[model samples]
Target: MMVAIAQERDRAAFARLFAHFAPKLKAYGMRAGADPHTAEEIAQEAMVAVWRKAASFNPAKASVSTWLFTIVRNKRIDMLRREGRPDLREEDFLHLEQPVETQDETYEANETGAVLADRIAGLPDDQALVIKKAFYEDKSHRAIAEELGLPLGTVKSRIRLALTRLKTTLPDS
Candidate 1:
């Protein structure tokens, strides 16, 4: 009955559909290794898609549960692909002109750098040192190792772990 109404774009049916399946979608995301917050966001997005696409749903070909889970699964795959892709490139900067350094812009840039430094400081001592050597000092991993009296592999791993932790902590730029 709800599915029929949803097929007709009934708002109440859509609300009922969301109420029933949103939690299951979130649980599915959690089981797929997303954090709880991320799971909730994924679930909400999936349900919103369901509402928008309900008119196309074919009950003869698939159960509502199967259709809904398929949406969640597809969204998760898309998220993984996006995560695997490198969205930013250093070479992309070559095409852009430098910003005029207004007083406000300069102040904001300094403040942002200070905040980033503080965040880097909050990392484990080894991680912080590796980040500083590699990024702040603009040294290559091999050069960082030679400077720090550490093996190249160790420096590489430390920098990688530091970057992962930093990504988890930082707001999206």
Candidate 2:
């Protein structure tokens, strides 16, 4: 059906695709915190993009549902950006100021961090690698699994073990 729409520009194929995905996309947007009206707009915009950009879709990279949902997500972000900031008042800035850190406090933080890094280095290579990817590099367990060609459960287990080891080794402040 997608191939038909992309290669032949078949309206029938597009109609069927839109019918199947539009409501699901709207529900997805709502679940992502969009109001009903915004969710509807997101669904419409995603369908329009599918009609326009169908040729760019690659089955090997993502399934049709994934592609459609990605389009909906992008459309929602664009709409939010265009909407711009809401009206702001003085109260909005009340919590903006952060207390300055003392020199001794900053030095203690750096020492603690160095000790933690050393402890992490002492872990088994697999556990250390997963811990660094999950925390320092801010990658999800699923992403780490994909990148390392490991199972998700293995990635998660390594992180859990690394955290337990770190907790035991680190002294309480």
Candidate 3:
């Protein structure tokens, strides 16, 4: 049914998929510790993902529910992170209310960023790899673990240890 929607743009199949799974996805998000609004967002995003990525679905590998709940889980994380995230403004970094009048300020900013990069480079290889993958590459810990074929706990431990090292190494700001 979902594959039909993907390949043929079948609204009825999509409707059926939405009717069956949106509520369940919402409930799953709530059980996973999201509030109602976030749960609704996750359900909505997951359904959209089902529509967009359904062509990739293969019934032989996994059922629609398996595929969809996976999408829901990821969507929940993304939505909650966004809701809690601060809006990053240029002023927040440059410490200026308006456009900079000096190029020296830009140079200083780049130099400070370089120093931070040096500190990251100083971490142990395992710790630095996890930090880069998680922050720079923007991959989930589970994705990192699978890519590296390491246990999830090992990946998490590396990230935690790396963070602790960074916290101690970087001067308090």
Sort order, lDDT high to low: 2, 3, 1
Residue pair clashes in candidate 2:
none
What range of 10 consecutive residues in model 3 has the weakest lDDT sum?
Answer: 89-98
Off by over 4 Å in 1: 1-8, 83-173
Q: Which 10 residues in a row give candidate 2 its minimum summed lDDT?
A: 89-98
- What TM-score should be assigned to candidate 3? 0.46
Tens digits of per-residue lDDT, candidate 2, 28-61, equal 6676567899889889998988888878765444
Candidate 1's residue-wise lDDT over 5-124, tens digit each? 555667776676666678768877776667899889889898878776666655444445545656776676566445553433211222212233233322443455467667888999
Error of 3 at 101 (Å): 66
Q: State each model's CA lDDT, in order.
A: 0.64, 0.68, 0.67
Off by over 4 Å in 2: 82-173
Instruction: Write out the backbone clash pairs for model 3.
Output: none
TM-score preference between candidates 1 and 2, better one: 2
Best-first order by TM-score: 2, 3, 1
Kindly list the per-residue Cα lDDT of model 3 for residues 91-156, writing each as its tens digit. Answer: 113222223232232243345456767878898888888887775344789999999999999999
